[model samples]
Target chain A: MKASDEERRNDAVIIRTEGLTKHYVLGAETVRAVRQIDLTIERGEFVAIMGPSGSGKSTFMNMIGCLDTPTAGKYWLNGQLVSDLSDDQLARVRNREIGFVFQTFNLLPRATALHNVELPLIYAGVGSKERRRRAEEKLELVGLADRMDHKPPEMSGGQRQRVAVARALVNEPALLLADEPTGNLDSVTSEEIMAQMETLNENGQTIVLVTHEHDIAAHARRQVHLKDGLVEQDFLNEPVETSA
Target chain B: MLLFEIVMVAMGAVRANVLRSVLTTLGIVIGIAAVITMVALGEGAQQRVQEEINRMGTTILTIRPGQQMWGGVSRGDAQLSVEDAIALRAGSDGLLKVSPEQQSRMQVTYGRYNSNTQIMGVWPEYFEMYDHQLEAGRFFDQGEVQGRRRVAVLGYNVPETLGGTPPELLVGSTVQIRGIIFEVVGILEEKGDAAWIRPDDQIFIPQSTAQYRVMGGRDRLNSIYASTETPEELDQAFAAIDGIMRREHRIRVGEDADFNIRNSADLLETRNEANQTFALLLAGIAAISLIVGGIGIMNIMLVSVTERTREIGVRKALGATKRAIMTQFLVEALFLCTLGGLLGVAAGYGASELVTRMAEWDTSVAPEAVFTAIGFSAAVGLFFGLWPARRAAMLDPIDALRYE
Candidate 1:
């Protein structure tokens, strides 16, 4: 059953991490990529993680995305103790619960937009017929329906990013993870991508974006800023409106 | 991914660089072709030897004069004679037929063509032993042999040497051997070559006629050919002849026989064994090429895995398991090998045919060789494809994704 307006305030939290820590060994030197931190992200919330280089934002996003495990802490994704899962089990969790969107729009160079969008569902064991239908819907949702046959190299940067977005949404995952989504785009294309993000957020799609630019981070309703591998400031902002 | 999808992806990777894929599989193709062609040649030679044995009669045995050594081999060998054949015929219960044969080399002229060739003289039973076919006219009968008539049966090639005339036309021609004229009474059909012996090259005459007329009434013979009614009776025939010869010649026990016996069936077995060994040697040498082809696949696959590192990472990020990644690469290698194998089989078939056409070498391609070659090629693919697949599967997605 859909949650009514009264139960919206008690919406289930989709991502929760307690004392998550990531440490690296570089030839007798210890680098803490992520320090002990507790973070909770509720469903349908549009959130962004802001940090400079070496601030551990990417590392933190990798943990939340189930791409890497927390070294000595607990991670509960959709209420599962994912920190203790094996690499294969973590892969299952990543496939079923997360859809990653990289900054460079990491579409397979040789595959068409349609095939690129079908990749996540392919890993999920979805049959080709249904996979095609769902991928086409996601491409239409991201306004790249006409570019289904185009390869990444054939598309412009904005179109490529949209195809990536369609691929991310095709699986209907629990969370959308975008790392520096607009770092490689010009201002006009960035605004266009941010507007698409806003539309997705308005449709109650949960988002966790990682970016260094404040203007890009401003697109998310909530921002978690990091410094020295720890959360420095967490606040809410009025969402930037890009009319065009 | 589904099996077809994995195949499609692998095929796509191969198709992306068609030239490299073809060149990489060239090693496998050459390897398989070599194996098949060699086996075909060996098989062809074996069949030819077997046919020669069959044609000569498996139950047939030839007895040749054996040498006797005395005081460091100063003594001469014991020679076979008509009396020995008569003794063998009378004493050996297992003997079906015994024939005494004599041979002499002399120049023969029919009209103006004169050539020196071996002329064989034998009993009427020699025709039965060799299963001779008359292309024209008739064989000189037993009456002619007893009467010592000057009659000869021309072999298939004798007419060619005499006048390049057809065998049928030479049935009534007169051939003079060593200044004595003999009438050609029959013409034997062409038997071609068997192993190294050319049966078509010699003419035949009655033993009595040859001894009394040509050799001045000599009674000695060059060999004695004996045969058994059935193949199972050959050993008994051999033993009976040995016993009779020993008693007739007054040889002591444990002494070497005065003649050597050669069974056609045993020769056939030896030749077949030699052919088998030759086939094995050829296959062993050709297998090296398959291994070399496998190495080529491994090398190219390793390069492919490296080149597709980023794509592999993306697939892993999109939730592909290590098994899926591994299977994708393995299927790719399998494709390369099986493709090579098929091409090799075709090439092998063509090569064998080419050999037959160009050199007139008898070549037979056994179906088993084709199947074995294809099967081995697939195995090579699986074996060589393993390392690169495991390497791709074991790549850390996080590191791979970050790789340029």
Candidate 2:
């Protein structure tokens, strides 16, 4: 039987990079932020990019998240080339294909949790009712059903992070990108967020997490470590049994 | 749906800084209020002038004596006499109704009440020329004028000045003017003040009675009034009066006539033009204030954009387009300006009402003026909001996100 379009796209690589590079000119010298990295991640895979502060992981993540254009080379998200897209087109790609969860929980501080979760759908041109419904579902999935009306300032740090997670997932994007998601959380809350992400990966959600902490990187099924603007290690980990 | 979300976001941002927003709009409020009040006052003055024009007949002309020049040497003021008026009336060929007038302020007494009042001496045709209607009794006839009878016609407010007696009751009563007793033959209905003429407060008497008895035989008329049946006939009447006056005074056609003829309509039109120029100048000053107000809005909007830099970065990272960001800021500015406009209109209307009540001046707040004020304020919003909105839209998301 001929594969359906959705099935074909699901089988295709969710993210592919060919010699991706980014450089910044600091007066008299050029700084190579990300240098000649070729990478690929298939649908439903959980991966973590681990690096020290100056190891170029943030720059690589920004390029992969469609937040920054590369200085050289190609990037394909969901089988479509996106590295050369214009600023506005990159915004559209971010809205439709990639979901972002930030360490600071980047939810609009003044907006209620539900409103914050509905933002991506708003940019996706979804109807108000459908946006609310999908946002509610995602918030409920993140155990924030009772806190949907609370603003970021009114919520606990972990709860705000969960709200950010819900916001990131509400658009049903092909890739979920989390950059230092548990950076500001307590140990227990960080574990809680990581376990939630692990559950999401088991449910066939493709995830890419960026972090400097080894414990946070351990939650992903595979890990890639970077140093000096180049990948130094790529390895898979055995699934750790949950306490529950 | 996106548009609705954008509008909501803008509303939320404004609400978040309610005090700042209100304070920022104060300039626009004062500017629009000034514009509205100034326009209303100007319009009221124009309406008053129009009413004055209608009150003083547009088809009537006043003949006043100008300086008489002899062989290009300056002479003192010339005189217009009753005989010159008679000559114009006779030579008009049924095209003009002429009246010679003499007036003075004199003490008038009725019983125990006495007041200083204007006494007017005019021909019997004067009432018809001014279209004055009688409230009671009949006007003095030509026979009365010819026989020099001491008959008077009371003006609308003359009864009030003389002990507040009713017009109907005072018509047949005798009033002493300058120590001469005259019977009131008629009372005129109210005629409002028109420019220099206050006909409602003056009492009219026959020109012969005034010349022989009241004015002590002074034949020099103050001025002559000439009227045509239609405004279209004023030019012909003017030429005929000029010819007759020249012939009576023994002046040739090529010489400058001593008498100057003035059309009341033209004089009022000149006054109206001056009023309009003054109104425009005031409005121009008010418009400058509006522009100053627009600059104030621009200054505040730039501050807001700078303060909300991180918020803008978050929105952009969450997939907000440049157009969306621009629209958000623009809508906030537009909303602020429109709110100020509405408040200003209300304040201006209240101020105009206060003026009418306290100063007794006519003021009308036209709906078009209100709408134009609001529309102009909105335009100010768009014009001044552009730079700040553009600055917000062009921000790089990575740099903005990292903004402290």
Candidate 3:
């Protein structure tokens, strides 16, 4: 088959969900957390999934991140259909493809910044020498080279988040997924973290960020807003530049 | 993940909770110490018995008066006489020699010191039969026994207690047995407890002298020691002696024999068997503590799982499989048990030493007992740690992450 430009463009899409739905049976109540959602995110594109507290944005992000399977419908990542994958298989996909930056900056409290970044590689069965080298490089990338020996508790909130970001990017995952990455940081630190994200994206990395703040969502070129377990709007933004 | 890595990680977790881990291992330590101590006690007893057998020949037999029970109401042991000993030797084949013994508690004095101790009166053949060695002077001969002379052989400790005089100096010294002056002819070597006889504290005199003078003339003998040349002749020699005793005592046939002829080797064998059973029983009781120890590990591991739920969630989200989680907890349990087991071995050594010093008892710990104690602790770890480990592995990651 001769591939057309539009077809080739669609081929670049890293995440595509078709009629995805998730419902939980809580005792006598059936809560539909995510309703028939169809979305497509292409490679090298920065996108923000914006939603309020009960809008099911977190649930949808979980599906896209391979953290949860859809109750019914089709989902694909890097063109591989993963909706039917087993729990263990989905974990492998999450490890190799998705990098999570949690709202709370879930860095292991007892580990050094360098060791925290080395975790993904350790899970990937990398040797100690290689793990150390890659972890150092990632720590250096996030401008925390001197702070590599600091533990999460010992560091400032901003530095700890930066350590989390370095950990997220160390695996060279296909998509950087951050869920309210700046929830615990002050406004100034939030902007500093967004700048780091922008730099990574500018360097040809794909990022999908989940946030409730309009300003934080505006930093991405495209935004998808959700309401009541369904998509409310999808649009592109000019990414109005900000000064720190 | 590598096995070594899992163990290292598990050890790190265990080390982080130092007090709790050590507390969890306490039961295992106690269990292993009990097992080791019991085994050591049994072994020490067995060794003492063996030494006693060597001092007295294995083929030797002690003929004590048998119990006379009428309708299960015991009338105590019957009395034996020297006539029985003489008659057995006269009517016996495969018998080498016999010694009739009679004992009495008496007060003895030498110089300005005095002590109360046992005096054993026996024939000359008794010394050779018991492998008794003299430290100084000579043994009383049959002539002395027949003449009812007042010569006596002092035990090695007799001099040390009476006046602290040396063995050679005690020889030719006159000591009063039952307030009657008897000249010390020989000093016996320091032989410890053997054949249920404490030879180091007693004085030995001729049986004729004891029967006629000390007892005011009585023919009754306390016991008889008889032996054959070889171990193989033991059974036949017992039977011949039994016949002699029966005919002398004039007990009717098919009736309960008046005397009990027991071989030294048989007694030793029975004692060794009883010691084995005692050790095994003690170890079995001790193993229950290890099971209790394993349960402690499980309890602490469960608490740990709850406390580290968020950590488990993070690990699961980082691509750790259920198998990895299971391995981590299992390794943690095994580490605790093995650590406790090793510590218990050292404690058991200390315990045995304490037993030897404080209680004046012999205690020996065997290598096999140590190995078995360690292996049992591992089995306990595996057995009781299973449930908690599986519970940790099966936790839902999302729920765990959201857990407070």
Return the top candidate by DockQ. 2
What DockQ do the predictions score, one after another?
0.58, 0.63, 0.41
Q: Kindly report which residue stretches of model 1 are placed more than 4 angstroms away from their true locations once superposed.
A: A1-11, A238-244, B64-84, B110-113, B140-150, B159-175, B181-185, B208-223, B230-285
Residue-by-residue lDDT tens digits, candidate 1, A15-49: 87779999999999999999997888898989999
Enumerate residue pairs that collide in model 2. Answer: none
lDDT of 3 by residue, B91-144 (tens): 885375888999988888877888898988898888888778999999999899
Candidates' RMSD to native = 4.3, 4.1, 4.6
State how far residue B204 of model 3 sits from its true place (Å): 3.3
iRMS of each prediction: 1.3, 1.0, 1.5
Q: What is the CAPRI rating of model 3's predicted complex?
A: acceptable
Cα miss at A21, model 3 (Å)? 3.2
Interface RMSD of 1: 1.3
Query: Tens digit of lDDT per residue, candidate 1, span B3-79?
Result: 77899999999999889999999999999998889889888987787788878888888888887645346357787
Candidate 3 stretches with Cα past 4 Å from truth are A1-13, A79-81, A232-244, B23-59, B70-76, B87-92, B106-117, B136-153, B157-186, B206-209, B212-217, B228-258, B261-295, B342-352, B364-384
Prediction 2 global C-alpha lDDT: 0.88
Candidate 2 wrongly placed segments (more than 4 Å): A1-11, A238-244, B63-96, B109-114, B142-149, B160-176, B179-183, B208-213, B216-220, B228-285
Docking class of 2: medium
TM-score for every candidate vs. truth? 0.88, 0.88, 0.83
Error of 2 at B60 (Å): 3.5
